[model samples]
Target: MARPIWTGVLSFGLVSIPVGLYTATSAHTLRFHQLQRGTSDRIRNRRVNERTGEEVELDDIVKGFDAGDAYVLVEPDELDEIAPGRSKALEINGFVDLDAIDPIFFDRTYYLGPKSKDYAKVYALLERALAKSNRAGVATFVMRGREYLVALKSEEGILTLHTLHWADEIRDPREEVPDLPGSRVSAGAKEMRMAEQLIDTLAMDWDPEEFHDTYRDKVADLIKAKQAGETVEKAEPAAEATNVIDLTEALRASVERARAKGKQSKGKQSKGEQSKGEERKQRTGEQSRQGKGGKQGRTGRRQGRKESGLSELTKAELYERASAAGIPGRSGMKRDELIKALEQAGRQAA
Candidate 1:
C-alpha cells in the first residue's frame, strides 16, 4: 500500500482514534511537455520579474492580493503566523445525517485507516457507530497548508472521508441560469406516462466499469500511431440532442429502443446458455451426469419455479423473492403489486 499523506487522531467528543488519510483516486490522464516543432529540445518555465525582465529565484517569491488599485504583498512567514490552530488535528464538530449534506458540497474523497495495529479496534468501533446511526462526523483539518471541511463516515467495513466545498463557494443557479422553467412548459398525462415508461425501461443499477474515457483513449491511440509512423481517420455519427417537435413520439421511441436493447442482451445470454448445454450433451451423451441426477433434477425444478414470473408464486414465495431482490416497501405491497414491482426489478437487474 502507498504511504498515507496525512496522519492524526480523529476526535469525537472524548473518544479519539489514531488514523491516516490516503487519497482514494488517481489520474490516468496523458501528460505532455512543451517542445519546439522539429526539435527535440524541451522548453521549461521560469518565474520572471515583469518590470525588470529578469528571472527570479524561488526564495524571493511572495504572494500578493489585488486590492483595488494597489496590490497587498504578504510574506509566507506572516501568513503562517495566523494559521488555524486545528491544522494538526481533525476534531469533529458534530454528527449529522449523511443525507443532510448536499452532493454539490462534496469535492474529493479519501480513505481513512488506523495508523497502527493497536488502534484498529477503536477505528472499527467508530466505523460501526457512524454506519448504524446513518451519520457522518463533520470535521476541520489542514493539509498542504490549507484547511478543509470534511465528512468522515463508514463505507462498507472501512471509514471514508470526503472533502466539502464551503457554503459560500456554491453559486445560486437562479442568478446564473436565464429564464428558468417554473411550469412555463408542461406535458400531458399521456406524455408523462410515456416518459416514465422510457425511464423505467432504461433504469439500471450503478456499474462504474461500463463507462470509459473514450476521448482520452483516442488521444493515446493517436500518440502511439504517430510514434509507429501510421495515419488514422475515423468518423462516428453525431448524437441528437433534443426533439421539440413531438415530445410524446420521442418518449415512445426511446422506450422502444431501451426495451429492444434489453431483449438483445437476453437473446445473446440465452444463446450462450444453449451453446454450453449443447457442448455438454455432445461430450457426455446426457448420461455422465446420472450419479446425482435425481437430486439435481429436484433442485433444478425448484430453481425453475423461483425464476418463473411472480404470478406463479405464492404470497410467501413472492415476499421472499421481493426481499431477495432488495425491493423497497415490499411489506406493504399486495401480492399483485409485489408481482408487478418484482417483474420490473428483475428485468432491470438482468
Candidate 2:
C-alpha cells in the first residue's frame, strides 16, 4: 500500500512500459532527539553565515561548488539544465546475467509497478522474459536530482530495480585493509584442518527471528529504571582466557567447543526439524533456498577471517566494538587499550 515515489516510462528499443518506482526497504532503528540535560528543552540546529555569525534565511542560501581556492555559486535551475537523463525515462542500457553483477555494487532496491492498467501486459511480458532468461535489464535514470545505474530484474512476477554504485565509488580493499596488500602470515595444515572441523561442527540452520537486539532491549530497560527512580548497579566484568599461545591448541579447543555447542543445539530443535539444514529444503519454488548454505558458509568463513585478526582493525572500529560490548570507561581508553579490552570482551562472550 505504499505510494510510488516516481512515475516514469521504462524504455528498451521499441518496447515501453509506463511504470512507477516504490522503495522496497525501510529502517526500524529507534530515533532520538537532542535535549538539554535535566530538562525537556529540545536542541535545534541552525544554519548561520560563518562571517556574520547570523542565521541565514532559505531564500538567501545558494549552492556553491569548491573551485580550488574559491567557490562558484550556482542556481537551482542551472543544475536541471545539465542533468541530461531527468526526462522521465528509464532508458535500458542492455541486458546482462543477474549473477554477473557483484553484490557489493547494489545500493538500494525499489519495486517497479505498472503506472496504469493499460501497460500491465507489457510489464508482465518483460517480467516473464527476464525471469525465464535469468537476466537483468541494466539501465541509467535520474531520480531525486541524482543519476543512478540500476538493474531491473523479475522477482515473484514483479520487476525490482536495484540502484548500483558508480565505478569510482568502490575503494580498493588493499589500500584500506591491514595486512591484506602484503600479508606473510601462514598456517600449518593441522591448524587449518582443525579450523575447518570447527566450522563444519558449528554449521546450522539460521532463523533470523531467533536473533534480537540485546543492547537495544537493555537501553529500554535503563530508560524504564531511570523513570522509576531506581539506581542500577554496573554488571561485573567477565574473566577471559589469556594464557593460550599455540595455534593448534586454540583450533583444537575451538573445534571441541563447537561440537559441544552443536550437541546442545540438538535439544533445542523440534522433532519435525531437519538435520544440518534439511528444514529449509521445502521452501516455495518462487524463491530457491538451495544455495543459501553455500552463501552462509562463505559468510561465516569471511567473519572467521576477520575475527582472527583483531590487530588489523583500526582504532575507531575497535572503539565501536568496545562500545557495543558494553566496555565501561571506553571513552577514556587509548587505541591499544581498546583493542585489548575488545579481545577480552570477545573471549568472555565466546
Over 1-350, each residue of candidate 1 has an lDDT whose tens digit, in order, gives: 78999888888889888788999998867899999999999999989999998999999998899999999998877765676456658999999999999999999999999989998888889999999999999998887768899999899999999999999999999998999877768868998898888888989888443344656657776887999999667858897777777777788888998999899767755654454334333323323333335876555433433444345767656675566556787765656777777656644644
Q: Give the residue spans of candidate 2 off by over 4 A.
A: 84-87, 181-183, 231-244, 270-350
What TM-score goes with each of the models? Answer: 0.74, 0.70
Displacement of residue 11 (Cα, Å) in model 2 is 1.3
The clash tally of candidate 2 reads: 0
> Could you give me the TM-score of model 2 versus the true structure?
0.70
RMSD of each: 12.4, 16.5
After superposing all C-alphas onto the true structure, candidate 1 shows an RMSD in angstroms of 12.4
Candidate 2 has its poorest 10 consecutive residues by lDDT at 278-287
lDDT accuracy of residue 225 in candidate 2:
92
lDDT of each residue in 199-224, candidate 2, tens digit only? 88877677443344545545665777
Clashing pairs for model 2 are none
Candidate 1 stretches greater than 4 Å from native: 276-350
Per-residue lDDT for 132 in model 1? 99
- Judge candidate 1 at residue 172 and give its lDDT: 100
